[model samples]
Target: MQQFAGNSCSRQEMDELMQYVREAENDQLLHSALQQQWSSLQPEEPLYPVNWEGMYDTIVASPATENKVGLSPSPIPLIRRRWWAVAAILLVAAGGIWVWTKTPQQKTPPVIAAAKDIQPGSSGAVLTLADGSKVVLDSAANGNIATQANASITKRDGVISYGGKAPGVAANAPVGQPLMNTLTTPRGRQYKLVLPDGTTAWLNAASSIEYPVSFTGKERNVSVTGEVYFEVAAKSNAPFVVTTPQQQVTVLGTSFNMNAYTNESIARTTLLQGSVLVKIRNSQLKQSSYILEPGQQATGNAGGMLQVRDVHAEQFIAWTKGYFLFDHASVPDVMRQLERWYDIEVSYAGAVPQREFGGKLERNLPLSAVLKMLETSKVHCKVEGRHLTVLP
Candidate 1:
């Protein structure tokens, strides 16, 4: 079995083993043997890692005179549902290799079994008050979490809001240096906020937004790190301004998604509705600014010119909707997202796969299930604790 797993078996030996797997159901002796072997297996990990691609190629290349053997052809007739399970077990017991073909109904176990399974991230965040007090919102009951600057702070339906306006407060109300608060989400958490001016913001995992508890003077200004989606309330006199590490987006009333994580090479501001002006931070000498209409995006880097292009704006905000929508995204791009949401560290064992993925996956699935989905595209990985190492 170890020799077979290591691809040391002769062609004839491999062919006979595949044939045995294909016909294991009709042969009761083979079925019982496979079942006994599977049931007697211990919880210990496998001694040798299976070469999945090699084993699959060998099986498909075998000259089967009676039935076509590849997964795509599906020439062999499936006699019973239990037969598929038995055949998969037989393949694993014989060669330590198992391939999922067209059984969509069957639940796929993790590709690499671990002692503990990592769950998905949930809705949560930490709120830093103006006085430097921290409130863990997830564990707090869902109402009147705190009060700040004469504004009632409430958490309800997974959204934190600054309710109750300071009586007689006007857009041009005189204010001091302005009390600021920050809402931050950890790697394994997300959060939503309703700013004092009624603007809504959704913070993705490992992101944050710092804003005053109340809008004052001529404009409402905020700074953010990481990714955030916003629906700015319309106030002609008080334009909403969002400042990131690389750029600043100013709009009277607009919906947009901003991705400005420090690790990312480019800072992006994608506009969904209304108009926004994107300007490079401290680019006074160069003087760069771009006006983005709906369905347009502005991308720039530090000390670089801002570039605007058309895009499907909805795709950028899909994370706020509880799923990842990857449109021809590279492996590193996909893994970066997974790293934040699952709070897992990803490293490469060899050359990174120059592969692109396009699909929509739920954000609520376990890390293992998500990895299994990636395996369908031949992306393999080994998970140990909270670390996932991509394998070539």
Candidate 2:
């Protein structure tokens, strides 16, 4: 009797053996070959079997041929033993295929799910008056509140109204007094106010708007550090001026939006409804000025260089209308707007792709939904709590 060793049977050898068994027409010869292979197997050792249950069983159970030489009365046990061997062989083949085709599992970085649905222009900043007074204007509020000089300060229907009037003189009043006020908005808050000159201003989140009680000079100037939209009252004799870190905007009764956040290097002045003159610092001697007509924008860098270009007026003023409208804007630009509106932090984990996106976003939606929309256009974003990371 020839003995069969498990270790000596290579995959090629087993395949050849299976082919031989499949080709045998004599049942006695097939049974004798199988018994010899099985008897040689050590009791404590494992054996690999080929898969032949379906076709092999059908063939073994069929009527025998007339030329059967050493055929036995029963081949059921032989078929059963062969079935186990076939199963083992098939499992080994499957495992080899799996090993070759399987890919390594991907490792996903951790992400925070909070504030995943914050929309673009849903919230804004608030102004805390000098007397530790608070005024909520993101939504509707009640009746007339106070009067400042020539302005009637009223909080009716969720808006702060400042109707222009002449400054009243009180008996024995101090002359040339400066009544100071501070406008502050916490995270997830927003507010709007009408200045004494009938100019309308909207403040963004985590921002402040400081103004004097009255506009006394030939030029009315106000300073800001975050984002604000202004619709100046037309006063040709007294031009309205907006002062920021890099440049100043002078307008004669025009509407514009200014983004002058200290953390940002460039200050932007976008004209919406009128003309304005943009003057960069240190360029005063050269008299370098960019005159922006309606639907134009002037961008001033920290080095006092100004660039003027045409733009969509609606895109610039969309924040005041409770949305963010982007027309092929960059990733950093989009992130900056998100940080201000959501009052969150942003960091980049990988190289930021040089891609531009164009869309309009309502601030009332979830932050996750906003990021999902951005992802549809090759820009992937992940949120970790208040921190957002952009990936290329």
Candidate 2 lDDT over residue span 162-203, tens digit each: 566555333355675445456666766677877777888888
Point out the worst 10-residue segment of candidate 2 by lDDT.
96-105
Among the numbered candidates, top lDDT falls to 1
lDDT of 1 at 318: 87
Query: How many angstroms is residue 78 displaced in model 1 relative to the true structure, after the best TM-score fit?
Result: 30
Q: Judge candidate 1 against the unseen true structure and give its global Cα lDDT, from 0 to 1.
A: 0.74
Model 2: lDDT equals 0.60
Model 1 C-alpha lDDT per residue in residues 1-392, reported as the tens digit of each score? 33333334554565576566666455676567556665654325553344444434333432221122222334445453354455444454442332322212213442443323689999999999877999999899988988775888999989998876663243454645667789999999999999999999999999999988878669999999999999999999999999998999999998999999987879999999999999988776454798999999999976778888898788899899998866657789889999999999999987786655544467887887677656644567888889999977
In candidate 2, how many clashes are counted? 28
**Each model's RMSD to truth, in Å?**
10.9, 23.8
lDDT, each prediction: 0.74, 0.60
Identify the runs in model 1 with alpha carbons over 4 angstroms from their true place. Answer: 1-116, 167-175, 284-287
